[model samples]
Target: MLTIDTCSSADVDRLLGLADQFLDDWAEDAVQGGKPDEDYEQRSTEWKVIRPLLVSAPTMFKGLKEIARIRQSSSDPVAICCAALARTALDGFLIAEGT
Candidate 1:
């Protein structure tokens, strides 16, 4: 449910690439219980590798807003806009976790 207000097609591509990479890393970590660098304390604290992804959330939210506006002419504009907004909010946490 992630959307981005990308300035250009290149930004959209970059965002998707980053998302894919994050999912791959998360899947691998899940299979392994966690990353190799995860010590007891580190595991208990915040995950450091995901910091960059966290910073990208606002851009993604803006993107979703743009998408909702673009689709506003649909039969169910409210539903569509609400869905887009929901996706934007979820993307905040998902991107934060790099998932």
Candidate 2:
């Protein structure tokens, strides 16, 4: 439920939290004996977690989609990568806003 109007530090925090959780799930999935809920893609921005962001944060969404396309085409998928993309998108938005 991340809309442009309601976007704030909380949104950023949510993004970071999602990133951290994905990282943990990835680690557990890799280490064995791990029962992580939902798969990797599910936890990404592509899912319901930030569905509104798709329109609310179109810039970030488009960038993420492009990266996803590129990575899926060529590149090893990383658990923390989505989070990094989110961070980068935020950075880019901030820079563009001049604030």
Candidate 3:
């Protein structure tokens, strides 16, 4: 991961912007009912895009631990769980990719 001292201002700005957009979109999805194909595509794209960014994030370790905890608590066939575990794993991958 690149330290703050090594990262350019533009990189930080871009990361923050992407994070903000992701959060906003996620929030919007929370209110919807059935999932759309585009939602899956967007999430996949997000995973691909953010994985590398997370490597440089300041809170990567904390985020990873949280993901681990969620995964550990998950039962078999993970999909049977409330989707929380899947979300957590997705989050972890995203962070790791960033690195």
Candidate 4:
């Protein structure tokens, strides 16, 4: 697994933004059981942070009709996946950014 000596505030902040973006889109979709918009790229910085969240979000919200499910649940496999992805991002972002 990739690992980093430290995580930057920018990276962490971007990660949080990514997380929030997903939540916002998901909330919009939940309002009427509609699907989310899909105009985003797979290679952008937001996408880099949002990718893992998008990939695992379904599993994170499965069998639940409301976003409250996420708040009420104590354990979720998606959380584990996100944790792993966050670690990988911290370690790999430098390489990914060619720094």
TM-score top scorer: 1
**After superposing candidate 1, which stretches have Cα over 4 Å from the reference?**
1-46, 74-99
After superposition on all CA atoms, how large is the RMSD of candidate 1? Answer: 10.4
Candidate with more favorable, higher TM-score: 1 or 2: 1
Against the true structure, what is every candidate's RMSD?
A: 10.4, 15.6, 13.4, 15.3
User: For model 1, how does the per-residue alpha-carbon lDDT over 1-99 read when each residue is reduced to its tens digit?
Assistant: 433333445565576577668656765765576445444335424434664555665676566666666666776767786767766776674686576
Better of 1 and 4 by TM-score: 1
The worst-scoring run of ten residues by lDDT in candidate 4 lies at 60-69
Rank list by lDDT: 3, 1, 2, 4
- In lDDT terms, which candidate is top? 3
lDDT for each residue of candidate 4 in 1-99, tens digit (9 for 90 to 100): 222324444455666687768866755655564553454332234656766764553344332323333434535777555555555554454586456
Please list the residue runs of candidate 4 whose C-alpha ends up more than 4 Å from where it truly belongs after superposition. 1-3, 34-99
lDDT of 2 at 40: 55
Root mean square deviation (Cα) for candidate 2: 15.6
Score residue 29 of candidate 1 by CA lDDT: 64
lDDT of each: 0.59, 0.59, 0.60, 0.50
The residue pairs in collision within model 1 are: 4-63, 5-63
Q: Give the per-residue lDDT digits (tens) of candidate 3, residues 8-98.
A: 5566667777866876687577547565557656765787698666545545544545655666666756534635654565566567667
Better of 1 and 3 by TM-score: 1
Question: Model 2 reaches what TM-score against the true structure?
Answer: 0.30
**Candidate 2 residue-wise lDDT, 6-70, digit = tens:** 56655666776776676667767755746544555466434546545533564555566566556
